[model samples]
Target chain A: MIDVFLDNGPAYLAGFRMTLALTAVAGVASLVFGTILAALRVAPLRPLRVLATGYVELLRNTPLTLVFFGMVLVAPQFGIIPPIGFWTAIICLTLYTSAFVCEALRSGINSVGVGQAEAARAIGLTFGQSLALVIFPQAVRTVIPPLINVIIALAKNTSVAAGFAVVELVATGRRLGQAIPGEAVTILGGIAILYLLFTIPAGLFATRIEQKVAFAR
Target chain B: MRTRMTRAAALGAVALLALGACASNGGGDGAADVDAGDFPEGSTMARLADAGSIKIGTKFDQPLFGLVGPNGVPEGFDVEIGKLVAGELGIDEGDIEWIETVSSVREDSIANGTVDIIVATYTINDTRKEKVSFAGPYYLAGQSLLTLKTNTDIQGVDDIGGMKICTASGSTPEQNLLENYPDAEVVPFGQYSDCLEPLRNNQVHAISTDNVILAGFAAEHDDLEVRGEQFTEEPYGIGLAKDDTDFRNFINDVLEKIFEDGRWVEAWEATAGTVLPTPEPPTIDRY
Candidate 1:
């Protein structure tokens, strides 16, 4: 096991790094985009709400692999070539993950009391102001755990990029496994451990944040 | 209860008859009349001959080499070669169990004894020889490029510098690009077919792999054409468990027999020869 790591340290590290980069970029982008979509779902404009709802329904219902296929294979026919490697994977993951994130945030937004929205409206606050200030603050606190879960899922979903040409952790493991068939078990176990290193820490951090924001209702 | 038992026995008999018919229909017309008694005692050939069955591994997706035919059995040059070897062991085509061994798992499959032999257009390299012994580079392929018909930019390997070349992951071509052509951007996919869409979409500049495999793809699609002469010599070999000299020699001998008897030419003409002219038979390295 140790020899496996020692021999293929650079490859394992490079793959781990790529996974981290993908997760980090996609995670942050989806959080931002999903929050906006969530806001749109709860907005006063009917068309915006319908559009956001349609996007979430369509994307979240579709398989991630199909989404990747569309982005890599289908999208290019229309001249929407997104540079094929890292960015393409980033776009696919974000598109797929943001929908789940949108639903999670929308649920959190709905969890906020109707009275709070009415109270903000009773004042001079507009829709955007109420969402950004009164509603979003509370919604974010409630949604952190679920939102982190989505991000964690996104991290694992980066494996799909392996098929499309991005040499992420799983692809790296596969390459290493092929190069040294004898050490496949050790290489795969090491990859699993590397994934945990990201996910477990993020889970614990979410827990810490959740406890920190645990206010008496 | 007696009537029901009689009905069940009749159904079982019908099923057995149907299976027998299917088996006879599916068996290819290449079973050799080798005497099992000719092999020395305790040898792999004698053991396999006694058992009257052999498990062969090959690629199911590679078109000219080992594509799965409409009858659900794989039919290609490699598969035909497999049948010839099995026939020498007194095993019929129906008794040869075909296992799909993709590029990456060929070594592992042989090492773990999941396959008696592999004829998956397997490229013989020193790295693989450490894990599994190889026999009869029965065919010699070379690393080449496949591009769109209209594309005039990449004519050969020299034009591939700084271009995106898609190839199967964990394959010799991928390694070749990574090692030899450092300037070329290597895009590795799970299978050669997986690269086709990307190549068609212009995401990859060209597809690079074995010339025969490229020819297989080109034969399937009108738009794609194989470009550039073969850059690297890829000796296609039969993979088996390492250090099994008896089995290796037996397979080599079978290959030599087929080469002389014109059975190899017939197999090639019926499969890969549709798209490629049959070349000189590669020398069997009896190492």
Candidate 2:
């Protein structure tokens, strides 16, 4: 059993690496895409806002695993994917996670005073400029904590990648534990440590940002 | 405020760097193989001779074939056969390395030398043989369609048309269901256990896999029954990498010895004597 770990340690490590990479990439992509979607939700055009609202509602109400499965199984018929499960997992995770992120950021945008955008407009700023200079900064300050929380959620959610056999952290730990029988505790402990390595700092960073933003106020 | 945000970002960078360092500096010597040749480096027999033990992989979830026992140890027919083979190679059962085998990953496990042999309830099929070698068609398995015992409309595999069936993702059964019942919606699960739970809940109309496995499930749950006779020939084999002819021949010889010495009968009694119908002993051949 110990020998199994000794032999397959690299595979476990590779799985961890893939998990971390996918999480980081998905998290950053969701933040950017979600912020834009949130901005659109509050834009002057009712039609655009309605479309953005519908997207958020549609995604947030659905399960992540189902999104992944649909993307993997159904996409090939439309030529969206030839037969790649890995890409399907990433795309689904980004889409699903971005919806939640959009809601969080949009709530932050709501918390920003309506007067700030009006004041910027009165000062001869265009709509984009008003949002970019006056409203967005305050919105970003309010949104940092929730955005960080979303990232952590995204990191943890990468475990679902294993459903498609895209080797990720949870699946790697399981495979390692199975390989080295009687070491399930150790293997899972290692996984926890790896996950904490990301989450702990992320939590700390979010709190730190929250403190700074609050201190400024 | 700007300085504080920069500090936080810097701290994040440091944390990421620490993670990167941990990854590069982990305890491994980093000399792992990416392919089957990594084992024995060149010779399978020599590698076993050097290690003084044989490593076998089997499932720890199926009841009669391989499953985790109440004692937290792996038990079942395939596991028993693995132990017998290990004993033949001059190693005690304790000396044998046991790894978890899932149907989705079993082939790669053998091909990559993650396991020397897979006694997982692996069905012998032509597609699998193209990837790895097999020692015995030791057990004959049959494909049976499983539906709720209360549901009488789906009488057999024939009734499965246009109904949703659950199968292990990427398995031959999934392909078989698609080829045979084109209109029946097939849902794939990561494991057989996943399919079975939903099957009992009626989330899926039928669960299709090997008949022996379905029989084992039926034996455990009185509410579940195997409806039709065996539909497919799913002979089971002990899997090894195709290049490991020496290991292959060794396992085959060990199997014959076990059959002759009545150890095979004992194994059947130990793992599935009660759940299965009766043991049909294979004709012995001296390899």
Candidate 3:
């Protein structure tokens, strides 16, 4: 209805850029960090496994809203003072998303048969070598779908960063809707469509990957 | 299995039809009475009263405007206004249900029926009037900066060039800085509460928002203070669905009454005086 964004396109676009950046950073960080935590989770040593387990459980159990609140509230106390919207959302989302990623990858690692590791060891490979050459490759293929799911989830969760003033999609919509009186539904709907433009394709891709993995099995 | 699927479809159809019926045939005469014949037939308030109680949205973090007090009860100026609006409708303040809104959810909360009205510190701007209706210039505020008491480098809005300033999303401060101070960098957080903690730790050079809200930070941390004159004029108002002219008129009338009867002054004094300098009361000048 009312096209307020047309008048304030620059501000909305600025917010959109921040949203995209935050999501990309969180997605990548979660993937890399979670992979390490998953490997640690699947490690044979009890202490290493315990440390990974603790991180997963603690992060998973806490609400992301609280985590974000903590990030804005507590992160600075730790000397991690992000000087711009760019770093605060990325760093906080990285921490929040990594917890879920670790769990997802750990499950993926579990799906990888132990016999592969055993075969690597039998062939005279070291533990790290066995994991890199045998276990990790197999685990990655198995976890692709779920990891994609997490990526989509992380993308959606990036909207929460708007609360911290991260210029993401939802915040953009909020600004537009507030700017226009009679067009909130239209404005918010446009935002939802934008989010779907990103997420629906990701969900479909993940589903397709799952189908392929299932077919392989 | 096919029969079950058909049944589910039928149920969904029924729900849709019910919603359509509610939308079309709803809105009793209460809101129409307030509209002074300016509103179209069947406004949001009439429909809401047909269902009972105005569902107002507000923040749970902004201290004096809208926030959860130490007792974990929602209390603040905006919260009080939400109650008073409902009371003017002859509904009890307790009957006025609250929908918790953050900076990101305020607009959608109204559009989606999550709230029938928004009493958040929502600025009524030309851009905002397109999507939702605003009742009055309920409060007059300005964008300003807050910094740690010990910091000396930044004096006001001007010194923040290339410095990190903390703000929340969907706020005017971010827009003001980028437009006026192109050299300044902004760090956005989800809530106003987030900005101050970072300020306390020196993570940011300054915190920017309405001077009134920054006053809350000043009250909380004796180390913080509002610096410089009020930089930008920000007029706060209540938000309702754009189609809800009946509801909007009723709200405007209530605002007018409060502004004149001195009750509004008492409310302002009881709440805003601690963080803000005692000033002349705001008048309802809704066009």
Candidate 4:
């Protein structure tokens, strides 16, 4: 088992690097894209709110694997050639996770009392300014916990990328397990450790920031 | 809150460590259960005979080879072969335990006693010999190219230059194809079925897998055809534990009996012959 670890350490590291890069890219993209959707969901216009609501409801209700299969299998009929494994996973991850992230931020926006938005309007701010300036800061504390949860979910969800044949951490671990027989536990455990080593720290940082800027309530 | 979170994290880490310890222990010492009950000693066959049942593993996906039937039972050429082997061991076919062994975990399943044998479309190779012994190269197959029905240019592997070629992940064919066609964009999927969509849509120019598997797919889809002659030979071997030489030899003898009695041909005709022409069975490599 130790031999499996020693032999595949570099491969596992490479896979971990890929996983981290995937998580980073998806995390940032989802945050940006999701924020826009959240803004749309809460906008005064009913059509924008319905459209955002439709997207979030549709994606959140569907399984991620099915979404991936649909994109790869069905997209070709429409002449959209999805990229190979890595980029395919990134696209699916961004699309799926943005829905959840949008919901989180929307709930956070709601948690900021209506009085805050009224105050923004009292200061002669427009709809965008009101969100960008007053309500968003207060909403951050409410969003932190669920946002962190979504981030963790997104990171772990990268495991499904293995189905598409990307050599991410789980797939690397699987290949190592196959190469060095009878080390399924060691290979999988090592992968879990590598994931925790980084993800736990990220979670801790989120918690720290959450505390420092915690809402008075 | 900090203490609770810290304690939870510590608990999780410790639990994971404990699981790892248990598995490593299983790998080292707990794998000797073949010696537990015995009508006679010195051979896995005798032990299995005493145990009165045998667990057989085969692929649960490949159609006409090892797929589960409409009845929710494993029914294919490999499954029938497993049934025959179980019957020879004095175990009734109904009593046989069918385990699904994917390509990558064949060795591990043998080592851990998850299955007494694997009959998946397992290609025998030297790299695998270090971990598990093989018996009875019962089926002869070869790597073949699969292309959309409209393709005319890709008659062989040489035409895959700069083509987007796909194969099942973790398969030797994938390794061979990637090594030979360095310029081809290699796309791999976990299951052979996953590759079909991309091929149908022309997202990938070609699919390469064992002829046996490709034949099954081609039979199912009118718009898909297996093109070219075989590029490489792959002998399908029955995998067993490395130390189980007696059992391996016994399996080889059973395979020989089936071949001699025409049961092998009958089994193939019942399943794969629906799509594939009859081919001579590969001879065994006794170790």
The TM-scores of all predictions, comma-separated, are 0.77, 0.48, 0.62, 0.70
How does candidate 1 fare on TM-score?
0.77
Global Cα RMSD, each model: 7.8, 19.9, 14.0, 14.2
True-vs-predicted CA distance for residue A122, candidate 3, Å: 2.0
Residues B68-102, model 3: lDDT tens digits: 75445577788877776765554545457877888
In model 2, the Cα lDDT at residue B88 comes to: 57
Q: What shift in Å separates residue B140 of candidate 2 from its native position after superposition?
A: 4.6
TM (chain A), candidate 2: 0.90
Residue pairs that clash (backbone atoms under 3 angstroms), model 4: none
lDDT per residue for candidate 1 within A100-175, as digits (tens), equals 9999998888889999999998898988898899998998899889998999999999998988899989988888
DockQ of each: 0.39, 0.04, 0.33, 0.24
Q: What is the C-alpha lDDT profile of model 1 across B1-287, one tens digit per residue?
A: 99998988887688678668867766545566665688988888888888888899999988989988544778799998998999888788778899999989999999888989999989888988899999998989898899999999999999999899998777767877887899999898778888998988788989998889888999899999988778989899999999989889989999999999998999999988886757888888877
**Among these predicted structures, which one has the highest TM-score?**
1
Pick by lDDT: 2 or 3, better one: 3
Name the 10 consecutive residues with the lowest summed lDDT in model 1 chain B: B26-35
Q: Rate the local accuracy (lDDT) of all candidates.
A: 0.89, 0.75, 0.75, 0.83
Q: Rank the candidates by DockQ, best first.
A: 1, 3, 4, 2
Q: What's the lDDT for residue B247 in model 2? A: 74
CAPRI-wise, candidate 2 is incorrect
Ranking by TM-score: 1, 4, 3, 2
